[model samples]
Target: MSQNSGTEILRYTAFSADPAGGNPAGVVLDASGLDAAAMLAVAAELGYSESAFLTGRNEPGHDGPPAVREYTIRYFSPKAEVPFCGHATVAAALALAERDGPGDLVFRTSAGPVPVTVAREGGELRATLTSVAPEVMDIAPDDLAEALAALDWPAGDLDPALPPRIAYAGARHLVVAAATRERLADLDYDFARLEALMHRLDLTTLQLVWRSSSTVFHVRDPFPVGGVVEDPATGAAAAAFGAYARALGLVPDTATLTLHQGEDLGRPGTLTVELRSDDVRVRVSGTGTRIEG
Candidate 1:
């Protein structure tokens, strides 16, 4: 138990094998008595992209028995509570795997039920989470213009192959593709303006992507609504991007995509996004490691 909170707050980085190479997240394996305020406080104090809290097990509407590894999970950002967060989910699942052994776990989130599978591969444990059924919608022209303006990116720099869209897999993200890798590398923007636009559009992050190949691409997330300038490796956004790619015919229905992220931030991480022909939900897999303080 932590001295201040009286609960063990584990720190881990998701989507990378190296502790300092991924998006760091705070994980509280057991947070039964904490209220929303306490959870928010914990998240704010950690100052990570997000933090996950396991509320409890054997909820009223879960699928498995009381003894099963099923629990209600909640995610909180530094500034507010979010419906879902991918990196934090991976961090929490890996933390649980360290204690309870890895297999299958279901997290009932505010958005919906998310199932995660953890397996030991060689010396490291990797986890894959199946996102909720994804949906992709077109962004309005005026809204697109506003987003581009806030980003200070010219419309001509937008990729013609991947149209602008608002994608949702648990949380909403605006998908904007850069025509070139150079355009993706330059990330300076009006933080306040973008934050205002994201708030009005109810966007969690802007999934800025650039295609390197059919299966390989680079991604960056501007998470203004979460009170962060950027998210190094975002799981929810990656899941949403998979759906967007499939919906826009950018990739085949059943294909695997490798997403390279956080490189520019000097915290490189890789995320694998798999789309199955039989399932509408996307799967995001990555390696997580403990970040010792």
Candidate 2:
């Protein structure tokens, strides 16, 4: 642990290098002494969508980047803890790059081990996280109805191409594509009702989306479970959605997808998702900027 035992909370915005573009994440570079309660308190105080805590460091893996680069990371929402978080992961990576000079960083999370790489690409400090093995499941009709009611969205508004399904890369998210961009932009829902449905289904967030093209999409994530109304740019959900697209054969085996988010909230951010031909792991990339005090 660093000599300064007091928790050091570093603010970072993920998905976009610009501080105002991506989702802001509070990062505690060294969380050696803080307990669970303390971490949660810090997260709540910061009031960002989520915050990341790096508990410690470790030796790098065989296929991993460095010889001695390992970190145990935890994420907290305003209300509670989550199994995993994408934007926080990206934010943490950029923060690490600022200190250790950007290479490969491995994070040991409750969900699993996630590998991240940060490098300068075209004057942009891009960070990519390889998600845990992905999985997808069908949404039951009854559950879909309940979810639709919660969102106050009629069943007819859903896109026929992308049916309601639950996708998981690092965390589980409900994937629901809208028929039109206009429908996607209008995002008002019963927060309480959605929260109840999410709790019942063990969903981390609702991946509300609209496909702009074969490789581009617009997304919004409702994170009631984490006690947030919406996430500007969610890495976890993007990773999961990438898997969903691949499983449905919507995109080629190896393809890159762009997600435009937070526009409706006026905090527009972009996330790039890549699906490899040989691997089930989805790679989500974004730029993060340090949050100045």
Candidate 3:
């Protein structure tokens, strides 16, 4: 725990090695003294999609390396605290790996306990987080219609194979698939209207997707509920989308999917989603790099 008034706030971009090619996240390695207001202030000042704060870590009970290092983590967006955030989690894991050698880590988040594993891959540090049990639920017809209207997308524009639904891994997201890549790229929507609709649905972001192949996808996230127009890379949405795909029988029970996001924003990043045949949890993996000022 760091009690100093000037706690170091590290900036790291997740899912990409290049600083300008991924979603940037503010990571506070130690945030013991900062209260909720202070955390919110720091996130608001940074104005990123989300920031991660490491409140404290438990002592190593056993001998070598301990089984897993448990830590308390909190995620805050610019406007409010979120239940879980994927990009910030990756950033925080890489930051920890820099100090302590990579292995297994458990983060006690507001939503639940999330397990992350960090390892060096091809000279770059990569982190994989196992999401909590995922679930897919049906969306009300009226709500879906309202959301489509807000995005100015007609019902016919949606993919008949992929139906609209609400999916949750750590956070809630409305999964809507676009019929074509062009439709997904052109994202000019009423911010206020979409924000209101998302708030009413208790959604974190609208996961807009276009399937390029059976296992390859392009995704965009409209995050007006978080005070952002769009998120360059959204890990939570990716996890939910994985659950959505599995629920819809779009992919086999055990499969790995690739999600390409942030390309339209010129900050391209790749997120790998893996689904296991025995586990209901989703695994999201990506590489992260520190952004030096």
Candidate 4:
């Protein structure tokens, strides 16, 4: 761990090679000595959308680094702890890759075990994380209406092809698609109402999306529950959206989709999502860069 000002917090940006782009995440490679409260305090001080802490690792003989590369990871937002966070996972994997070289790593998260593979893509390092078995469930009519009201969006503004549903990969998210790009661009919501709704529904973010092509989509995540107005780039929500799209038959059994996110926020990043015919789990890949202080 690199200590600065008596604290070891590493900053990285996921889904983009440029430090100015993508979603920034704080990563603590070694947090074994810190408790949950201390970890949360660090995350809050960083004020990123999410922060990752490597609380434990299975190392043989107390070696320099684990040969198996299995780690116990925890994610925390400025407000509370979350089951999983994709951007932070990617950031952490890239951080480890810089030290341990590119390879496979497994993270034992609160939700489940997430396997990540890191490799050099072109001039930058990229990480692909295979999410836990995803599930898509119907949204209650009342809940859907309430969510729409919170966003001040009418039912008519929704895309008929993409129905509203609740999807879970590592964390729960409400997937809602707009009929037009213009509608998706205008995002001004009632933070308190949305936060309350998300708390009641146990949601991390609202995956607001618009399809620009058969395989290209634009997405935005409202994360009032995380104490962030909006997530610049949300990898967890992208994975859930992939499951939602596949369940709706919007994509083929095996396909690749590109998600363009954070453009409106000026931190544009690209996320590549892959779905296999035999595997129910979704794979999301993106490059990450170390954020300079």
Candidate lDDT (C-alpha), each: 0.94, 0.90, 0.93, 0.94
Sort all candidates by lDDT, best to worst.
4, 1, 3, 2
| Tens-digit per-residue lDDT, 1-293, candidate 1 | 24435868999999999987989999998899899999999999889989999998865446545544788999999999999999999999999999989989999999999999999999899999999999999999999999999999999999998899999999999999999999999999999999999999999999999999999999999998888999999999999999999998889999999999999999999999999999999999999999987
lDDT of 3 by residue, 154-239 (tens): 88888989999999999999999999998998899999999999889899999999999999999999999888999999999999
**Candidate 2 local lDDT, 267-292, one digit each (tens):** 88999999999999999998878868
For model 3, the superposed segments whose C-alpha errors exceed 4 Å read 1-5, 62-65
Model 2 CA lDDT for position 150: 87
Instruction: Say which prediction, candidate 2 or candidate 3, comes out ahead on lDDT.
Output: 3
Worst 10 residues of 3 by lDDT: 1-10
Q: C-alpha displacement of 156 in model 4, angstroms?
A: 0.9
lDDT of 2 at 80: 92
Q: Model 4 clash pairs?
A: none
TM-score of model 1 (CA atoms): 0.96
lDDT value for model 2: 0.90
State which candidate, 2 or 3, has the greater TM-score. 3
Candidate 4 Cα lDDT to native: 0.94
After aligning candidate 4 to the native by TM-score, how far in Å is the CA of 268 from where it should be? 0.2
